[model samples]
Target: MPDETTDTTAVAEQRIAALAAAHPWVSEARLTPDGVLLVTPHPRATAALPTPGPLVGEHLAHWEEVYEWTYETAEGRHAGDLDLSGWRASDTGEPLPTAHMRDWVDRTVGLVLAQGPNRLLELGCGTGLLAHRLAPRLEGYVGTDVAAVAVDRLSGAGLPRAAFVRAAAHETETPPVRQAMEQVFGAGVRPDCVLLNSVTQCFPDLAYLSAFLHSALTVVEDGGTVIVGDIRHAGLLEDHFGRVERARDPEAADADIAARVASAVAEDRELSFAPAAVQRILAAHSRTVRMSVHARTMAYDSELTRYRYDLVLHVGPAPGTAAVSETRQLPWPGRGSEPLAVLLRKALSAGPVVLHGIPNALLTDAPDAVTPHDLRQALTGTDAAVLLDAGDPRMLAVAAPADRATAATARSLRAPVGRLAHEPLPAFVQRRLPEVLRDHLRRTQPGTVLPRIVVDDAPKGAVR
Candidate 1:
């Protein structure tokens, strides 16, 4: 049998090494007096590491190498049992290394503080960097990851306010992780915000990635927000920075490397969005979509990169309600009075007024452009109105030789008017205009001519 004391020491060292590998910033991790491991000398000691290549197809083989050793090593396997919560202080005796990690924790903390303390669930809460940072500002915080070792470490760290769940990526069936998530968040709890920071790109493919995204949405409450940040295909350093190689012909080698790197980035990597694919998927499930890109330096890379994030705000309508109308129009400028207003008033006074307008360019632009206030003022006294919406042909057909008086009377209204061309009017209005006017005149006993005068006292039978 293996020597127990020696094996234990070896196991401890191996576990520490695995953690350091998985978490780049972790320099040294030792078991504390309380069984918690203290990580010392943060990863920032060295200049930023080169960005990794894309995780796609053949490139995935290279990418796997970066994580497998750290994840599968002997120490890494047993790290699940080591707890860090009981440790009073880190071996480094320094504050958490914020510089090397993404600033999302700070941003999230600020958002929670401003919006009132909210329950937060951070998926892929690596090393609990963001969880620890946001715990104080949240009513409850739960973090879930596939790494059992990380869960054990978090438990030992004494973060009573935050709970950890060991769930593998794309493995929702994992019982330990699922149960832990439900216990802290509560069966009824739906996240107000679901944060996916530099996490989505790690998936094996877009199909897997989208499935997780949908799951995240399902867990978020209606009217909640999903914040996703980080640039896809951002790990390609050779493409980002030109390489200088010494060769028989230095210039030629440099050119060749540049060409190769460019080709590699172009062929092996691309953003996760597939044309209008994301929009199409979100439309069916989400109510509103807001997206923006901010240029920032990566905490680990220190190189300038564009951070693209999309916030899908849920806004489903009330049950049984029809879809809201979506009509937007800017008020017309330079039109002072509105004909609709005057027509409404006239209709209210005399039972209903017929509004006439020519379809000429001037008229087309006039009434429709009038301000709402002006239109309201014009219609203030009217009870009901009908728009003549007449083109030039319709206007000409209605304004007959005998109807000149009526046309002149309509022209005198303070509303904007358009000149009509000489043409026969549309049959519908031509047939209805006379009947409308006749009824109005008979009811109000105004003058009988087309432009009937609004006479206070007129013989009722004069026009008849």
Candidate 2:
């Protein structure tokens, strides 16, 4: 038998060909867009991504042990196993019920809304910590995890508004999740918000996040929000090392920082992130999103200042508008403000705006039109749409409903565009309108600086 891991590229390809031949429906077997077969620049970074446990079995004996690890019903207390926090603070110190943990949970709940979203589904529902807390907020809430022990415990406690289920990672066992979701809500029910709070850290790689995100897109209803909550940036991990050293050695608060981090590298749980990684992935789908930065809060009696800053993201627009981007990773092309762009921003502030009848060529390009890749990149996060007319002049209009208002907002951007605007916006925008036309709209307009972000207004939505 051929060893699967040791197979050469030619051998792997030949096997794929044979497998395709045996399957009649196999149109073609292919690699991913990023060429998974071609390169893995940082394999070790995502190697230990979490999987199902508590454990994966059909027998009763395993569950009995799962129960033993977590609960001492005799003592009426929670314990080891199935709880994410079990190993997290094991070496830190005894629990004094820190305020930081509570703050984290409360801040997380705030994202679903202060007063809306009738239904919510949370993936990787670790111990239902957030689930139990959120029961009173929404009409229906579903929390799912692979650990049957945790599910069994939460289900037994019986929160009225929430239900817990045993389900594997969304990638490996998507059907089970869909089924469990149906069982909890009903056959045709869909959640308004899908939460992955502090969860993606466990995944094997960005590839897993990508697969699960696509799965989420299929499962979530249109205009429904997908909250990819509490993810790390490359900088967060660096900040953490300093905090860890401080915690471990109070006297050496000013110790050689680099050396301390090097010594603790293998002994500690290191974080991993790819720069602007999640944004790049979401860009491909064109889903509107708002990202905010979250830092860890501390309890009164806590002995540590842990390194953590949760990035909260809100995906899917209120009704219209989808977020786009300049590059796979960058949100904006850094083309600063243009006349029309500024005018549109003001119009949006007061209410929705519609451009007067203009040439359709500006959109679909009749002849000298707007189709360049760089041109498209400049228009990344606008909330406007193109009007399709059979023969009449085409127009561009904001996509929000008739009564649109500038509600709460979240925005993120790296570069300042005020200086860049001097370069001038492409002639396509100017072509849509005559140069002498701006005096009328500028009367009521207040200058507002728009940042280039996928979307805005959430926990981390205002991130720079």
> For this target, which candidate reaches the highest TM-score against the unseen true structure?
2
lDDT for each candidate structure:
0.38, 0.42
Most lDDT-accurate candidate: 2
> On residues 272-389, what C-alpha lDDT tens digit does candidate 2 reach at each position?
3432454455566656654433322223212222322334344456444422221111112222355445544444443343322222222234432321222223333754332211
Candidate 2, which ten residues in sequence have the lowest lDDT sum? 455-464
RMSD of each: 34.3, 22.3
Q: Report how far off residue 110 is in candidate 1 (Å).
A: 4.5
TM-scores, each model vs. reference: 0.42, 0.50
